[model samples]
Target: MRIGEVLHMNGGNGDSSYANNSLLQQNVILMTKPITEEAITSLYSSLSNPKSISIADLGCSSGPNTLLAVSNLVKAVDNHRKKLRRRHSPEFQIYLNDLPTNDFNTIFQSLPKHRREIAGDGSGLCFFNGVPGSFYGRLFPTDSLHFVHSSYSLHWLSQVPKGIEENKGNICMAAYYDQFEQDFSTFLKCRSKELVKGGRMVLTMQGRPSQNPTCHLWELLALALNEIVAEGFAEEEKLNSFNVPLYTPSLAEAKLVVEKEGSFSIECLEASQIYWTGYNGSDDYEVNSGYGVARSVRAVAEPMLVSHFGEGIIDELFHKYTEMIVDSISTRPETTQFTNVIVSVIKM
Candidate 1:
C-alpha cells in the first residue's frame, strides 16, 4: 500500500476525530516533557544564546497535542531566557510537519489562538509554517534547523515491508527488524544534514521491551479483525493481505542503528510505560474502559483501515475489537500498558 497516500489520523474535532481522542498521545507528550525541554535548553546554551531558533516537529499530526508540544518547547526556551536574564527572547521559526494528507488546515486555523496564548505569556515572537511530507526522507534545507522533535511517528515504515504476504493473521510487521533499521538509519542521515552543527533532536515512540515485537494491543486488533472475517463481515483474503506499517523496536535495536549511522551522538535513551487508558494516577472507568481505548485506536487507525478494508466494515470491526479488549483486560489488566522509548541525540 502507498502509506503516504493512505496514512493519516482522522481529522477535525468530531467525536471520532484524532483531535478529540488523542488524550493518550497528549499524555505521552506530557510524560516526555522533561527530556524534550532539557534537550532544547542544552542546545540553546551550547549556541551561546542565538537571536533566532528554528525547530521542526516531524509527524506533527493535528490536534491539541500538536500545539501542546510546540507550546512546551517554546515555554522551555522562554523560561531559560528569563533564567539567564537575557534582554530579549529568541525569535522562533516553527515548522509543523506531517504527511501530505494530514489536517494542516485545522492546525492553521487554530494558530490565531495559539499565537495569542504565546503572546499572553510574554514569550518570544513566533512564526509558524506547515510542512506536509514524509519524514523518512529529507524535509528541511541543509543546516537550517536547530532542534527536531517527533513523537509516536517514527515507528511507521515508509512502506510495507517486502515478503510479508505469507505472514497471515497478523497486522503488525513485528518480524521484520531489517526494515526498521533501514528506515531509522535513513531518518538519522536526513536529520543530520538538516540540523546545524551542535543541533539536537528528541524522539519518542512505541517500543518493545526486548527483541520480541509482541504488541498486546495489536494482537487484540488482529483477533478482532479475524472475528470480523469469520462473521462474514469482511473477506479473509483481505485480512491476510493487510498489515500495519509499524515496527516498535527494542532499545538495543534503536541504539545499534544510531551507532551504525554515525551521524549523531546518543545523549540519552530510556524507556517508560503508559497505560492504554492514558491514566497517570487513579484510574477512571470512563477513561480506562475498553470503549475509551478502542476509540483512541480508531482515531489513529481508521483512515488507513478505510483505505484498505472499505468503510463498511470499520464500525463492526471496532465494535468487536472493543469487546475483545474488555475481555482481555479483565483477564490480564497488568498487560494494558504500552512501552515507550524516548531518545535525545546531538549532531556529532
Candidate 2:
C-alpha cells in the first residue's frame, strides 16, 4: 500500500489516539528542544530587527506532541525579543504540514484554545494554518519559510524502498539503503526550494546505531507478528506482503544524504538513545513499560496494520506485542532503546 494514502497516527483524543500515547515522541521533542531553540535563535539573529517570521513544522502528526516543538520555537522567539527589549515580537505565520490523510481537524480544533493561551501570554501575533500534503515535495511558495522544524519524523520514506525483493518477516525498510538515501536527498532538495536564503531547518528523525542498523524494538514487533502468523492468526502470505514504509537511517547516512543533496549545509547532526517507554522513574518500568511501548507503537503503526491485517487483529496483535515487549525488557533491557538523530541545517 502507498504510505501517503494510508499512513496516519490514530486521530482524536480517544484512548487509542496518538494524542494519548505519544510519550516516546514527546520525550524526543523535549530532548531536541535545545537544538530547536538554538536554530531559531541563530535564524533570528541573522535578521536585523525582524518583524515577522514564517515557520513550518513538517510531518506534524496530530497529537499533543504536535504543537510542542512549534510552541518552543515561538517561546524562544518571544524570549529573544524580551532580551533585545524590542517593542514588538515578530509576527509568526506557522504552517503545520502533514500527509493529506492526517488528522488535520483535530489540529484545527485545538487551535482556538491554543490561540487564546498564546494571546494571554502576550507573546506575539501568530497565525496558524494546516497544510495537508507530503513533505517530499514543495508545500509552499518560493522563499516563503524562514525556519522549519520536524521531530520524530523524516525517517519515513515517501514509499517503500525499491531494489529489495524480500525483507521476509522484517517490515522495516532497512534492506534498501540506496533507495532510502535517494528519497532523502529528494526530500531535502524539495525543502531547499521553499526556504529563503539563510533559512534553517531543524529535524529529529528515528535512527539506528551505526554499529547496528536494526533497531531491536521493531525487530521485536516483527517477532510478535511472526508468532501470530505461526498460530494461524495471520496468513503467511499476508505477512509477507506487509511492510512498514519507514527506515531508521544512521547518523552517517543522514549526513551523507544532506551532503549529497548539496542544497543545505548541515550545522549539527547528533544521535541520542531513548527508551521505548520514555520511562521517567515515576512509573513502574516492568509493569507499565510494555504497555507504554505497545501504545506508542499502536498509535503510529495501527493504520498500516489495519490496512493489511484487517481491523480485527489490532487489539489482539498489540496485546501479543505487549507480552513480547515485556519478555524482551525482562531479558535484555538494552534492547528496548532506539537512537534518534537530530539534525540542524542552514540553507546556503
Worst 10 residues of 1 by lDDT: 278-287
lDDT of 2 by residue, 103-191 (tens): 99989888888787676767788899989988888899998899999887788878776655356787775465776787788778888
Distance (Å) between predicted and true CA of 117, model 2?
A: 2.1
The CA lDDT of each predicted structure is: 0.90, 0.85
lDDT of 2: 0.85
In model 2, residue pairs whose N, Cα or C atoms come closer than 3 Å (at least 3 residues apart or on different chains), thus clashing, are none
| Best model per lDDT | 1
Residues 1-348 of candidate 1: C-alpha lDDT, one tens digit per residue = 789988899999998999989988999999999999999999877877688999999999998988888888999998988988887889899999999999999999999999999888888889999998889899999999999999999988888889887557889866667888999999999999999999999999899887777888889999999999999988888999898888898898899999999999999999999888854344645335788889999998998889889999999999888888888777888888889988999998
Which residues of candidate 1, in runs, are more than 4 Å off? 279-288
Determine which window of 10 residues in candidate 2 has minimal summed lDDT: 278-287
Q: Global lDDT for candidate 1?
A: 0.90
The estimated TM-scores of all candidates read: 0.97, 0.96
